[model samples]
Target: MVEQQQSDDNQKNSEPGVKNSIKKLKNKFVPGFQYTLIIATGFNISMLVIGCLNVHKCPVNKNIPLFLIATGAIGIISKFTTYVRTRFSKHIQVVYFETSLYSVESIFFFLGSYWVYKYYKPSYDPTDGDVYCNKTAYLLAFIYLTFLYSLLLVMIFGCCCAFCCLLCLGSGEDTSKAGCKYSLLVAAICNFAMLVIGCLNVHKCPVNEKIPLYLIATGAIGLVSKFVSYFRRRISAHVQVVFFETSLYSVEAAFFFLGTFWVYKEYKPSFDPDEKDYCNETAYMFAFVHLTIYYCFIVFVAFVCCCIVCVAICVSATADTGVKYTLIIAAALNISVLVVGCLNVHKCPVNKNIPLFLIAVGGIGLMSKFISYIRERLSELVTVAHLESSLYSAEVVFCFLGSYWVFKEYQPSYDPFDETKYCNKTAYLFAFSYLIIHYTIALAVLLACCCFTLCCMICTYKVRTCCQDMVSVEQENDTGIQYTLITAAIFNFAMLVVGSLNVHKCPVNKNIPLFLIAIGAIGLVSKFVSYIRDRLSKHVRVSYIESALYSVETIFFFLGTYWVYKEFKPSYNPLDRTKYCNKTAYLFAFIYLTVHYTILIAMIFGCCCFVCCAMWMAKAENSRSYDVESQPTNTEAREALTTNDESEAKP
Candidate 1:
């Protein structure tokens, strides 16, 4: 009798339409999650139908209503998948298939809802001349759809987290397996947040429809899959997830690159001969293009790394291996992007400093990835996580510093059509402050990482020094720690200088270069002298050569800045313009500025590469010892560092 009762219970559990405890409660209060979505979908479809029927009376294009219709259809399909999954939960294969379908549907629905809400929602002001405008009803529908859409995203992500937790509870404690789940959660949260914020402030946000709609569609679709993961948590379970994430990341990066390049390709290289004022230079268009491209790039990258926990979810490879591969792929994509960017940079609208800043960003990623590859091969001692965090921190610092300066220099007029108002102080200040604060926080985080890395390196070194065999290794590793410490100190010092100089005008133009020159000369001479002494002592050190190159590059950058300032004389006064320069001279100055900054940027980037590599390689070698076969010989390291330095010194 007990066996028969057990069989009956099992049969009941396996049957379709059976409710679990969670579902029972959910159904009683919420009218079924899937059913609610179906109802919401029906409401949206009704609204879209109304809009379409009155398209002739509406002032807007008919395409707007059609878009709403498509999105409504997507919502219906997504809800259908949800219903299937809920009803047939006992069928594992069906569950998996439905989950994938639901995820895709959710993506489409999210995008379609976002578009309709962003672009199609009518402004209900009664003063408007449009006769078909239903101000109150339309606003109410907009609010309802926006809420429903956001709730759908949040609920789906929440369900994934809940499911993951249940799985962990059912099995054993394994933290690594939970990473991709968290990544998805974070991505979904970000999307939801943006949706809320955008909807709340819909009237305030500006829309730029200049970017190719097709590319935008591709990017948006690719990015939506960022948070979705395979249900299986086996060794190979997350491989498909990684493939999709990385592939999408690459595609988004490609689109941004292409968009930036397209603008450059179309931009006229030379100023129009009939132009009246230098302030009205068409190059201002470059700033607008860059600004647009920047926002898109930032949005996509955010989708990829909303919080940047950087946890490895791919179980098939080592933790660092997965991360290294992701970064390597990203680097390759960035390189291709830079190649296109460089080819068109001459004509692209942007301040000379912006490209330089971009180069530094790209170079930082490439060097970090290369360091990871080398360390992995050599089996280095320091924890990959710690080192990566520190490196990322440094990259953030450099990025912010560059960003602040670029914004400071490239303030374009907001009103291109109005000739009288030549400057947009409000816009300039807004952009400058925003970029500055954004990077400042990033820099602070990086500085914290550097401090953490320092402590880790010291403690690890001390622990290893207790063993006699590790004494030499410790000494060698200390060089890298030293480099890191000095770099951090110098970075702090530079920031202080920037802060002080920015406060006072005379000090910045006069004192900053002199300060840099002094610092560079001292470091350059000391490193060169140390290199000579080390050679005489029958010891060869790559750090000295690397340091010397950085110093030289520093001097070159500062000197170039000064030279350009002195040579590129501009006349604000129309009366005595000939005394200072002609209109053609102004054009020449612009060209010179671009070329000059480009070379300086390249030199600085190269210097940073060699120094950072030298430091990372040095530390990584000491972090862990490897078999002599895979270990990089000191001679080889020196050769590689020197080769890079030499290349940097060239034009």
Candidate 2:
């Protein structure tokens, strides 16, 4: 009896342990899904690039590549959310973001499918003169969709088999419970049937319209019945509710079957663009794509329901190593950016600003990531400031500026006739849209910052009290100085990138941008090294080196600023490109010079104030010493009077 009791206690203790292990395993599945999704995004970006390269070929339908870019952008955001959730233990906001992305992506995928598959047999060769799409682009999209559908079917079949086995092993009560859930099965079946009817009658003019209306009514009634059953718990299990659900499903299924038969019997394709016939190719193609996706979604839902146990065991082994995966994703994205930019340059060499912008951003991003990796690996031996965020912030500013320019001066036209006059629409749109997304995000962040600042000002006392509790005064000062240096370094790096891109464009004073680039590079190195030295004083001693670098930077900045001002042109004439300097490059050079001068002036003003304060303190100290020396002491006066009295007595 004692041994039996001990065994029971052990089992009780192990139950919670088992439950916890299972919970952890379930939690890991989402990250695995995230990893898979990110990998898929890389493929999507590749397809977008291919489509962009062939944009001149598919002039009418830019939607394919546009959709790919849209999905890729959303995927990046989703990956970011996954990283944040994993890093911070934040769940609720991540869920909301994920759900929103999923819904938007679903709509985008359906529309893309409609557009891509509509031209079922488009000519592969450009010379064919038919509705042609690039063979590579078209095949990639087609294969992806085909594989997706096949996987859905397989998952659905596997789930059905699993469910049957479960039913066989289940007790009588379990079977009874399963029977009670027949309403759900009937609802799913009816939904599938409606989908088929919709697809069949999609191109049938009058009948197509009526079929959707019927489906909507059936869906509404089913939703209402389910809600009624849910709210009335006492009657949820009643015979009336079950009978009503069954009758509703049966009516919808029967109506859909009849519509399908009618459409199948009378179907005839109309090829004339202007004619209205029984079967419209356009409408049928659209409906067919949407309904097919809907069918896949149904199968997916059923698979999820039946394979919950399998999903629990589907946790990725690398889920815990999110940082490495994130780095990989970043690297892949940067490489794609570079490739796309290079392709754009190769296609249209007239406007190199936007392509070079892509190249610069991608290059800097990759460099920053490499530096971060090195810092992390050599964390014990060498200390490097976390400047990745600062670099990215600078990239955002440049992207916003570049996008503004693209929108104003270089917007591409979708007209096929204008292809020769403008850049490839696909490449131009990809760069423009990519930059615009970053621009919008940056704007939102700026607005949020402004709002938060306003709120802090209004609640200054509360903010101050909270900040005092969280951080020390010294820590606050250190953080401020550190960030200031980082900001300076980032600006210098930006100057280098912009200046190098524009250096070749200057006609007479080509050295202007080059000078700025050299000074900016020196200043950047100085600031970075100074920050490192300050942070790790024991390991690094570069005070004199930093001072010399800054001195040279100051001299070079003055010379560069003068050259830029002297050579600046206020107007740009695109037709006379040979005589005049590129206005865009000159403008950036001027901007960088002006900003650098402003910073230099501020620093000089601060140094003068420090000198004046120090001089005043010294003069005050000297005067106090002189006054003390000039004054007579009480003991000295008493001794002088005593001496006088003794002399008078002697006389």
Candidate 3:
């Protein structure tokens, strides 16, 4: 019996040991972790070699590479320690080596890389600017350094995030929120610093425009993602967040490191450097185009990935049907524009009508979506209340001046001295389109729809009032106003496009009206779809619409302003004096130029209004949360408290 018991006990102990061995084996091969280990080892060995070489060359420069070697060695050791703990230890204790050491090592490596590349001349001739360094060797070295530093950044970010998660795990909701908020604050600081440094040194040796752009894009994306993550943490962050971030950093590291070597090969360095500007201009243009296109791609992919993860994981925070459908419509619209762009393949604005049309539509959509969202949330917003009034005032002024200018200049027949009827007719047609469209169609629709909708809503509210239930009569009114404003804005935007195109008399420009009409028709369909979705779905999110608008606004506003001020220079045009100087037509040109400046001013105000509205909305959300939490069961008491608080604050 004793012998049997001893054998049974031994078997029981061996079972757990076998399982533990299997677990350790499984942990050793975590896909990214093992790769990280290999990279770390390679980095440390290379740094040591580089340090020894530099020490042999110059005694003073020895310390620089030595510091880098020391820091990098520490990083490799820390990474190994991390692996050992993860694979073998039952209780994994968080250590400073894995977190702070990575940052310290990254800084040292970054400085060392810059110093070596900037000073070391592999092969160069004083007579002609030429570097005869083994191109492949330099390229490989650059790639290895960039990969190491980028890995360090990813490691730091992961460690910070994981630490926060661990601290917040099993804590109360408030504590978790605080931890995430603090994490975000730290991330923002680090990213902003990186951006500033990259910008200041972007034009120097070993630094380029791509570096600054990467930092700026990364910072923007991280801030937005972290904000969303803080509010809702249902997504498997380890899989989604880390994967996207790793992809982004990896692309940056590989592209930029290789790009630097390509630049070196293309623009050979001189041993005896001169103060002559001999940059390859094509390189700048190529960089500009690449960054512009790729930045948008990166941001959009990141946002959509996060949205998918959030929607899939967070049951309570589901995406609105309207948002999904809007994305589909936007994708179709963008694809159509891309097709047009590919077909045209020209330099002139008139030839690029489709892309310009896309821009105009995006701007209009953003403005309309923003108006609708704000109207729904805050009916008493000062900006919304005054938007129509300001627009009408501007319209009345434009109408009187425009009519006077046209009538004064117009002649019945072809009289060159007096403005020809044809030219006069086109001018009047373009100039007064807003007033005519607004007075005839928009005004009628606004009045009839507003009155009918209000009547229906009032009746619905009366029935709900009798039943002692909350009625959305006010919300219905907001929706009504939203539709009206969107229609009006689209009309104005279409007219602007038509008027602008008319200024250029190319035959291709004639097709612009047809394009505008088609886009407007598509807009109507989209609005209809949105309406139906809003009616059936509980919520509508227009963030994509907002993003599109921002792009349009920034591009058109800045570019148009610069074009008018520099390229067109209506004030200094010789043609304005010779071609249309017969009957005080210059006055009309002046008026038109004034309108451009006015539009610029309006864009500025729109930006300000957007910022203010965002702040107000955030405040309102927080206050509502507080109210709900404090007054969960007391309806009348909550109402009284809200009334008192509002009165006190307002008065």
Candidate 4:
């Protein structure tokens, strides 16, 4: 009786485990979760639509176009798969569903793997001048385009590879792996073609123009990785990934990660729900930032090392050792500044607006330089006088002078004269362009000035540390350091009172939440700057708690300020737009932040819930859970035994 009762409980409990999961699935697929899923899926589909439209709009095969196309197609298919899995049959579906999911992921992985191999080019920003261009852009097309082209090639090849793997682990042993075998063949062919194209490009391009050829080779690698993975995976259900092979695979995957990101960066998406927008696109930006910063920092160090060697040669050649010593000391000073600027993003979070104005001035200088460089290259075609005058007062100053013109031309719906014409489904090809006019030159100027300041700080620090004991060097360092310190002190004071010297102004109208956020941030900056100014300090005018809390209250004060600003600014309305749901600008920012945080929380929670369920299931095994009637897919031997028992029985 006891044994029978225990057996019954075991069956009942175990049965509910599957039932709970099935029930959960039904709930998730049916209504609440389904709605959001559809929305997200639909959004991606819209982006795919835009991408497809754009591909035809400005077709180019170098790389970006294919990537956008592949991404759009893959994303739509993924969403479609979700819909099928949810609405379609449930049993034996997990394997098929998994296969589908893996297939989609493999496409991205393949694309990414090859992208990593693409030789990187310079960013769009004129500030990072590894390669100077005729134009400037916040969106670095060269870097981005190169990466995408690489990834697309990889993904195409990878899909073939995936097919091969699927066939190797064929749905049934009796069924032929024809589908996978064919895919393997195609992948192999594409890889060979890639090698051919790569070698061909090498000869076509000059040594200096080896960039184009390198990019092509990177693209080929992406395709090859896809081919290899597909062939191996198809043949073996559990292909043990060897370290040597895995390292090669890792390199392949890297191309996709790096390359796909560049493609994404170049996407000038319209307000298409399908595309990742300003807030959502931050993730892509971060990825680019990681790659670019790492790339720049490493390359710059190399450049600096080369420059140091040259400087040493220059010093050795100098007739006067005293002057040579002074020059070397100066060189050291410059090197220090570069180091410090690299450390904290040249203190970008500090004075931006003033730097912006300085950049505008610098823009004039660079415009002057570009025109002269071109004129020398193409002598007698363009005059120096017209070029020089055009730069000094022609571009940005005119725009600034015409601020009133902006107000006049501003259609309530759109900025009629908005310079940046980047957007939509057909945006990628177009997005690869640069603004050659004053904008680029001006932005570059600002960047250089900012760099100058950062360099100054770095040099100052180096002099103090490296020349602490040296008599003559110490004296020089003391003077230069004094000047740098004074300049920084003035800048920080200004920033605290307002914001970055580059673009800052105290707006009469303020959104409270943003203001509050700013206040809290500024307080932190103030404390940081104060610490930097003082070598050591113990005294406080007020208690730490009082001052800290006061800083936090700035946020509240700003909220109150905004409420007043809102009341006063009667005509200024954000919601009068014909298109776009006026979710309230500040409110939207907060909401966006909330949504991001919520997604993170939900993922963590979902993982925890899975762990809990698994643990509970493990404990339930204590009871006599074995049932004679239950047919488990535990082992082929057990199934064979059951078949033998059945055959022997003479029913």
Candidate 5:
């Protein structure tokens, strides 16, 4: 009996020890999971810095550095939001923000994966010519992707085991919790799998190129819609939001169905480096499975919708008028576009740009509709000024680059004998017209704004009575000007990317891109500093710093503008290319400089007008006060005027 008692005591002691160990493990795991993202973000920033510094030497794909910067920026922004929410606004939920950001990052990762892995084996030396990437950048990206997939597999296995255990041995509540977790895991896994397949590019098939773009656009729209819904509480209940989202998903589903058809039709077992139809068997099968899954999900959703409609009809329930009309309109438009694209898929054998044009048009229409919905239904709960500006900046850069590429590869007619010269005339014309219209409208608006500002200044000087009102107008206009400046800063970054790509090739002017990059970096940093200062304290003066940066930018703008103009040539002939500058880089640099010059002129005129008005008002107030004092004004009135003057001068 004594021996049994001793054994029981030992068992109880071991239980507490095991509990302590488990507690320690949980503590370590929790913090590790929390901080892993931050650590990865730091690594990403480091890679971006390194990539930028060695951009000229490395000649790495511009997309890689862009991806790094985008991911890093999102991570930093997320962390900032988390800090703000925790410290100042507990009412603000960050889950939606985080999820949207993660979705965007995942889309970027998919694109990056395609860019990096498509070259499976890239030359590290720049001298190896067009097919080279910086070794460090390439390996880091590869390893990060590999690690993510490995972690995903581990999570899948763990979730499966936990789910099985809960189903077999736990109570209903526990099983339900486990099931929720399992469903989330499954969704993540499926998303990752689809991304992997969509990014695979092993052949010259349009499906391979266009699938990624479709997936990216779908993800982007979804992220934006989620953001809108998150901020606008009423939007969550709105039928329009539901119809818009459903329409988007339906379009994606139909596109995926089309992709699956193409993939199956063009499947090949052998990989030939020289052949156009050289899809890897493994890659094709993976794409097939994922696309099939997507189509099946769409079918299932449609069936459910049909059943719901039937039940509603039986019960005499009525759908919202707006919802029904929106659904019909969206379905008609999306289906029409998809059917047209599918029918014309084979019309352009050499020019993939035709399909890109279709995709671009659809994307633009959807985005425009989404914007209209936001304008109509947006709540007053949150301001999306920065978000809108950021989107606009991205769109501007994308359109500009698309225009450049389209211009470069334009062919007037199809050539059966020469594959390089073959292009569908209709597609080329449509794309050209689309881009030209955009540029024409943009430039005209910019010129109109400049002319309006100039005219306003002239009128203000002539009519001194309106000086006070003009100053107030200018103050109100500050927000719009700030957005324009922000867009310019983003354009500067684009210029840097262009410069980096063309720097090595420009034998005559190697330092021009570098100079532009330096000035751009300085300008970007100045803007960031000004922003932080405004946020941290109202008393801090950033005008002097801003002035100095602007001065430098202006000086460089003139010098760079001169160099770009001097080096510009329209021809891309091999011999002429050696003598002239890269037309794309030079053209973008010129535009960047011109934008800065315009902003500088606007700022100068604005500041001058403000100062002149202030001086004129001060003189008038002095003259009026002197006259009042001469007339023997009461002491109380004089004291009141003195107090007002002091108050105005205090700042």
Candidate 6:
């Protein structure tokens, strides 16, 4: 009786993944995850039924059943597969069949994306009666379907690939392997087929549409799959080589952006000119067309390649084959980019600084993991954390001294404690102060972080060799300890990734952190220079003209201020400088002045003092009094005085 009961339970457990999947798959024959499939089918049916009755009255020739029930049939099949898998345990046999089905569907989707282009050719003249086609609709549906599979296939193929590679995704942790495997298989097959179909669609012609709807459909599947698969992570791997290779497409996008302004920039240079003489520019335009197509193909191929590589890593790592270099490489790329940003931000000439925030953002993920790793090591006070934190404190002094010396020598405004007058960027001073404090603490912690990582890596290496149990979440839970460890870990982690990417992308192949500091250093230097300029200027308070006279230095001061603000906003409040009134209030006043000036220019008594001065100078240079020595200044003439000094000279 116990044996029979055990058998029943085993059967029951397998049903959800396998049997339900079959049911879902069957239901798909009628309906699926997306309602659009049915809606599309219905619309096609309506068009078919309606068009037949009034085929003669139709504005232009159109396809009837070309998009009707048959189109919907494919979706129904897909849904049925999903439902069936949910009902039972997926055996390898069930998974194999599911994979096959999705693979078949992927092919049909590719064909559909381009089917209309061949049929509905266009004519320039309306009199030609050349039937027009909404190739867009077909492409849209194809893309929708293809990606839908991509989402499903990621898991399915991941499993297949994992099984082939690692022998299994999980040796024992995985349950419901029955129907689940089949669902996974279906998903994989869908992804594989979509990749294939997407590639085919890249060649579909989309001229009149002036858009690559078909190509978009192919690419959208992978992107959508990625998004859905991610949630869509309960959801879904070598994101590096994949994303990097895919960046080739980004180059395409870059070219596209450039072409809008630089018509000649491209993978294959093309021309765009007067339509009257198409030949001259046609070659150029044709090249752009080919390049665009190439990019589309690259996008599709990369999506699949990325998925495959990521999965391969997971499988290899899980199987203990030591295939972790790609992960490291990805980590490296992220860091490199961030470093590049840091360096370029500082190195690039003011007003043309590369955006660093965007580059650093990509490393956030690596940062998180790094922090987790650090938390593991630093949780114990007796560890390297204490020594490193202290060391950071010492580095703070040197960092500040270096910055101070550079500023005082280069920037005449290098007063850390002195009150600043109007026009001084108070916020910048505050940022420097805050940076002094934070950098001290951060350096200490990061120093600890670096030590901890190296030590941990050494230990991890040993542990891996010994085949010992790895640390789990339960290993470190102390909040205070966790905080110190995590922060240090995060900082270090970011550093590691930055370092691993060979620090090439950051500052675009330069040391970003150093670059930021250098930039701040330069800005600090300029501040002092600006202060000296202020002291030397005739007007103690220089406004518009003085600001212009001291343009280069003045601009550099503001650029430095901006860098401090952008790079260190969290370290200090710009308004607290006590330097030039409140930073916020000062900026507000400047803004108000600008607005007022704008309004004045729009009105009449409207001539701004600046504009008036310009006009006055222009007129004065060519006046009738040109040869008259000091020709009784204009005021004397206006006063009707004998163009002389006061009648009663001073005694």
True-structure RMSD, every candidate: 26.8, 28.3, 23.3, 31.7, 18.2, 37.5
Task: Give per-residue CA lDDT, model 2, range 1-651, as digits (tens).
Answer: 999999999999999999999889877875586568558656756765765566556643555555555555444444545544454454223443343344344435545565676566677777766566777767776776667656755754564565467557755555544565565556545545544454554435543444343343334334433333332332445323432333333333333333333333335645454655544554444434444454466457434533532342264343324654565576567667767876775454335466666665675555555545444444565433323333443343345345534654455554545645466666677777776665465446445534653564477656655774565866678679778987886777777777767765666665665675665666666676667666656866655344435434543654565467655564466455554566766777778767755764574456446546755886899999999989879999899999999999996
Q: Candidate 1 — worst ten consecutive residues by lDDT sum?
A: 275-284
As a whole number from 0 to 100, the lDDT of residue 478 in candidate 5 is: 55
TM-score of each: 0.30, 0.36, 0.29, 0.22, 0.45, 0.22
Which candidate has the top score in TM-score?
A: 5
Which candidate ranks first by lDDT, i.e. highest? Answer: 2
Q: What value does the lDDT take at residue 297 in candidate 4?
A: 57
Ranking by lDDT: 2, 5, 1, 3, 4, 6
Clashes of 5: 0
Candidate 6 per-residue C-alpha lDDT over 1-651 given as tens digits, one digit per residue, 9 for 90 to 100: 999999999998997879789787777854343355445445444443443343233123333223322334333443334434443335212332333234334433434444543444343244545453334433444455456556655764564454565435445536554455555455445434434543443333222222233223333343333333322123223122222222222222322322322222122322233332222223234434544565476456445545654565455434322324434554454455445544443332221112222232323323322332333333453232322222222223234433433233223243434424111232223224434554465557445544654575577666655754745443443234435544533443443333333322222112233333333332333333234333334543323222222222222222333222222222124343322222332232234334533553353222234335754785787574675765676876767664344555643
Model 2 residue 186 distance off true place after TM-score fit, in angstroms: 3.8
Better candidate number, 3 or 5, judged by lDDT: 5
The 0-to-1 C-alpha lDDT of every candidate, in the order given, reads: 0.45, 0.55, 0.43, 0.40, 0.53, 0.38
lDDT of 1: 0.45
Q: How many clashes in each structure?
A: 6, 0, 0, 40, 0, 87
Q: Across residues 1-651, which tens digit of lDDT does each residue of candidate 1 receive? A: 999999999898777555576577765854466457667657756755764565333343333443344344434444544554455446422332333333333433434444444446565554565533454334544565568646655866675676677667756546655675566556555434433433333342112222333233333443254433433234344234432333234334434444454444334433343433211122225333444665676556534442232422333244555666676676675465345334433332334434434554554455455555544543454334323433443454344455445544564554545443333343334335545564465457445545655575577666665777656765776577556546644643553344344322222133333333333333433333343433333554333233323433333333334333533455534465243333332333245346645764474455446546755886788666655667888999999999999999996
Minimal lDDT window, size 10, model 5: 226-235
lDDT (10s digit) by residue, model 4, range 511-614: 33334333333333333333333322343222222222232333233233324333332332334332222123334334433453466457445634654575
Q: What is the lDDT of residue 269 in candidate 6?
A: 24
| Model 6 TM-score on a 0 to 1 scale | 0.22
Model 5, runs deviating above 4 Å: 1-38, 59-70, 91-100, 114-139, 169-283, 289-293, 296-318, 353-651
Candidate 5 lDDT at 206 equals 36
